[model samples]
Target: MNARDPQLPLQPDEASQIGAFAQAMWDEHIVPELTHYIAIPAKSPMFDADWEKNGHIDTVLRRAAQWVEQQKVAGLTLEVIRAPGRTPVIFFEIPATKAGSTDTVLLYGHLDKQPEFSGWRSDLGPWTPKYEDGKLYGRGGADDGYAVYAALTAILALDRQGIPRPRCVGLIETCEESGSFDLPLYIEQLGKRLGNVSLVVCLDSGAGDYDRLWLTTSLRGNVTGTLKVEVLTEGIHSGDNSGVAPSSFRIMRQLLDRLEDAKSGHLLPTDFHCEIPPERVVQAQTTADILGEEVYKRMPWACGGDGGPVLPVTTDPLQVLLNRTWRPTLSVTGVDGMPSISNAGNVLRPFTAFKLSLRLPPLVDGNEAALKLKALLEDNAPYNARVSFVPDGRAGAYGATGWNTPDIAPWLSGALESASQTHFGTPVGYIGQGGTIPLMGMLQKGFPKAQMMVCGVLGPKSNAHGPNEFLHVPYGKRLTAAVAQVIAAHP
Candidate 1:
């Protein structure tokens, strides 16, 4: 898309008015709908194995579609598209006011949520929405059920102000939390419907802070699976096996040692590593200067809480950002074959099993990394004991290469700055997200010429996919206005 100097559509007074309208929309419409939405246990397909049979997915999709239709924006169309054995896609569209304008803006989000994790405060539950201190606590609201509402509100705000905007499409899928397994099918079937697009806006990312708008320029993909090691046929008395055989847990540690340094938390494999782009490094330094202590303070560090006090690996904010977004890391998410402490006895476990999760840099191929990891961990087992590395899933990484930056970057930057200063009293910030949204990579590949923007309200301590996940109400409103500004300035 060619860049043109699009004048600021909203003056100071007009921006104030739009901000108020956006806030009102959130308080009166978005929050109420979100409360109802949070009540549905609409877990993703991975978590809810019987999602289709339980009918929760269908129920929530219908509810969301009904609400969007009720908005009744002029020239708006909403469709619920379904393919065999795949989750539904809610396709929403608004025609551009300028006749014959073919420029399309694709806005993306998801309704399916991560499983209801444990450890919520006594009063907060995953399915129960709570509003307090300007924060709405729930599972899917921020991580993002508010996406469809926010996207449409932006266009609606522009239309209300009589600002010319490009044709807009809002695509909300139901399988994102499960790694977007079904999105490709819908994209294939609806390719024609999504014509040549000027820009793609994804509202399913992270924000470094609430004081300003944060844009995600990169995302680390992941490979997940189980690693198992067996040394003995059955559990034996510790007294008998203590000196006779190697502990299975020890064997498991040896296997993992081949992949990562236990003390330094560094991935040992060279293929899993990548060089961080210079632009991203500069962005990280600028962001660090803007947020020094807040970088780690914003986390849910235990002030003697139940999770216990924890320290960041490093005090330097720049390194923290780089380590999270531009580096490879490994985590042990779950384990099996170990008895509970209460039921445990003095015995040598027959086998040790662990769920392995690895985060690869944006430039690494998840499939290739997984293959290398399997070889590194499963081969040459200590004592020739039985070992297995079964990779259950892999999603490749994504990077917003310099070429993805459209000519309209300056205009979009101005819009973000205006919106942030008007509502947040701070300048906008740019940062990369540490988590994965595999769809970004897919879209980037399919529309290599399209400009992309990634922004979301999953800010500090929002705890998406964890206990007490929440959406900041005020930030949500301001974000809606920011989106409106971008749409209004698109040329």
Candidate 2:
């Protein structure tokens, strides 16, 4: 069969063929591969410090590369690139089937997983693969383990129908969960090999719901660090020090007070905030109308003392969406210098340490915000108690910056609409994600003219980082087909 023209729109029959092929591929090949992938705890370098030594990252990388090689896609070339003291990346390229096309479509994903968080169902676990009711439940499978498989499947689906596509390249990195700290080095080394990137298909984002295709319009930046306060050299009897020495925990509170409003959960530093774009605000309102109260109701809130569900900060869907996507927030993820409640005693602890994670608005510079955060927490110490804030070195000196996508080209936008309507029976939806993806900002700067299609399968309740994380297999299949349709229509 002769390859179709790249400039042409995909016919209904071609789209159907792509969808069918994607569905069959997911059932026959991708699901089993993801099942094995979920079993391996290929944690990111940040969570697993000895990632290289542990070899889990390498195992997943090698396995994914082997799978790609086994596919035997025509004109495809693959390589597993590694650098000293960095996680490995699987880079693959397939020449354009369309004549005289130099534009490249970069498909991006990550193999690394977050640390195993608690609270799985009794019958499920982070490492135990369970495929029930069209959902693949486990770590990494949805968060991103399915990406490499889905990407290749999309291209193969197009090829199987002789639908023409531009040059396609895959960059599957193992350090994305670690803020993609090592990606800069690899990007620099690859340089011209990346070609003239005209489009990027990032599968490491989230979907608003499983009903339609969702495009991540923006991403929040992240700054994480440890804040420690010391008031004594050793533990002292509470009776002896309660009235005399300052409490380390109290000092810790005072330090954090300068950064956040305990009563309102708002970050006090104005520098951390940005003026939300008018377009994004309008989009948020539209999304709020579509999602309604599901925006806040989706959170797993705990019960209160009154036997009612603990309320969220707000119930307005617009505010909820804006707060998560465009607002800066502070979270104390971990604590130290305190004994467990079961082992508690009448001792005054020597120090208090908190692992602080700060989410910055899309326009805020993360590197500068990180530096400001270090200063805010360490500058003033009550009672001369020692205080310090050390940013996470794993993210490098320049912290992870948020991304605001460039304006969508008309052709690409039309393609998204067609793909969504064809595959999902709905139009494409746009929403900003609260999570950070460091690569998006880097790619925007590197390829200023590229159109980014950042979408994924982490729909409501899929829970990417938390326990009981799952990939909605039905959504994944549809999403893969949508990707192929869009690529075939790329010009």
Candidate 3:
């Protein structure tokens, strides 16, 4: 009956209470605030060129801080710390009443979101929250916005049952979508205020299923930049320039060919790839088996008009998983100098530019990858037309392949399983997310000994950063209870 027992999972009554509390918190508080949050258009600093001027980032931050303060958790200390010229961080501390507890658990999340992408459902948009089928549909809800709320709610759930936990710190940043460029400074400034961390729980990751808790063990890094190609000083009539002037768009495509296979989507440059660890391959195979067709089916294949029914490069689920999580890939996210179809004229454009986003393997050196990409693209410029490849916002990959899963994961795995079974009648799942959270790599370096548990509600069909983005309300509630159980049993 001891609430402090480290060897036990939560009892049925305790789990039920936690779940109910989490549900109520989501329904009554988080969902409402999240709706307002979605409305703010709090794009990351990179996307919001006039972020400070627009005041949307500040507005969302203040709103979040206000909501956290209103929670009125006993012994809670909340602060909005601002380093000049950086997005503000929302820091919260919840004290533990355990007799001799000294360790602190750092829970990480972000408030800044990706820019509003095109192609939302007619009934849904990025900034408008819609409640449907137990999902809170909005841009940031599932991707993040729920982290601090969930973290605090979990603690409150435990407190309601008088269960003891490690002291908790909720560190929510506002620049994750922009590769978390500002986080290192905040971590350094906080110094000892962050305390001796024994566990780092991150809620900004992907889930394998809505029916189970998924733990992310690895994250790919990001290398992003712009590639520009110029052919002429000004546009000319297509008939006059036909077959004479090289199309800048065509030159751009040729430059991209130096990096990736035009047909297979493979990174042609050997330097862009790294040796995939055997353990990761094994883990991927097992996870693929667990997910089966859910691996691909979960995606909203033709959401709106953005993408079609594209077949994966491989039919083997394991290969697809490994390709996504442990390989290098390139995406041309945005383009410039291309006229809209509606505005198109019979003119050959003078220049073309593209935003290149490359996802790196977990152990690959992102800086090196960027340098190599720049060299490859700039080396043999097609037509020797003015070409430039500028690299920006490089984040090194995070790999825990050689590192042992800390003592805390087993306890959390058990908690996740029990919670999942109770809530969804399914076993918990483990995955390595293809997306990057630079904070994990930063925290790993800062807290070398800290046990890490990365979980999230961004399961398939959540479509984060895309149209119809949503938070699975039920799974979120279950995840909240699972977090409470882990904290209750943390050694």
Report RMSD (Å) for each prediction in the order shown.
3.6, 1.2, 3.2
Full ranking by TM-score: 2, 3, 1
* Candidate with the larger lDDT of 1 and 2: 2
Q: Estimate each model's TM-score.
A: 0.92, 0.98, 0.93
What is the C-alpha lDDT profile of model 1 across 406-481, one tens digit per residue?
Answer: 3336767787777778778898888877788877877878888777788899998999999999999999999988
lDDT of each: 0.83, 0.92, 0.81
**TM-score, structure 1 vs. true:** 0.92
For residues 1-491, write the lDDT of model 3, one tens digit per residue: 22466445567887788888888998898888887887778899879888988998888888888888888877899999999888889999988757678999999888998888988889888888888989988788887988888888888888877777778998999988887777888899999999989888888887888777777878887788899999999999999886999999888888888888989999887777788777777878889998888787666555445455766677789988988888888898999998899999999999999998899887776667777777888886878899998776534421111112334456566666776677667877778888888888778778888888888998878888888898988888888887877777677
Clashes of each: 0, 0, 0
Q: Model 2 over residues 1-491: C-alpha lDDT tens digits?
A: 24555566788888888999999999999999999999999999889988888999999999999999999999999999999888889999999988888899999999999989999999999999999999999999998999999999999998888888889999999988878888989999989999999999999999998999999999999998889999889999999779799889988888889989999999999999999999999999999999999998887889988998899899999999999999999999899998999999999999999989999999998899999888888885899889888887554544689999899999889989999999999999999999999989999999999999999998999998898999999999999999998898888
- Give the Å shift of residue 306 in candidate 1: 17
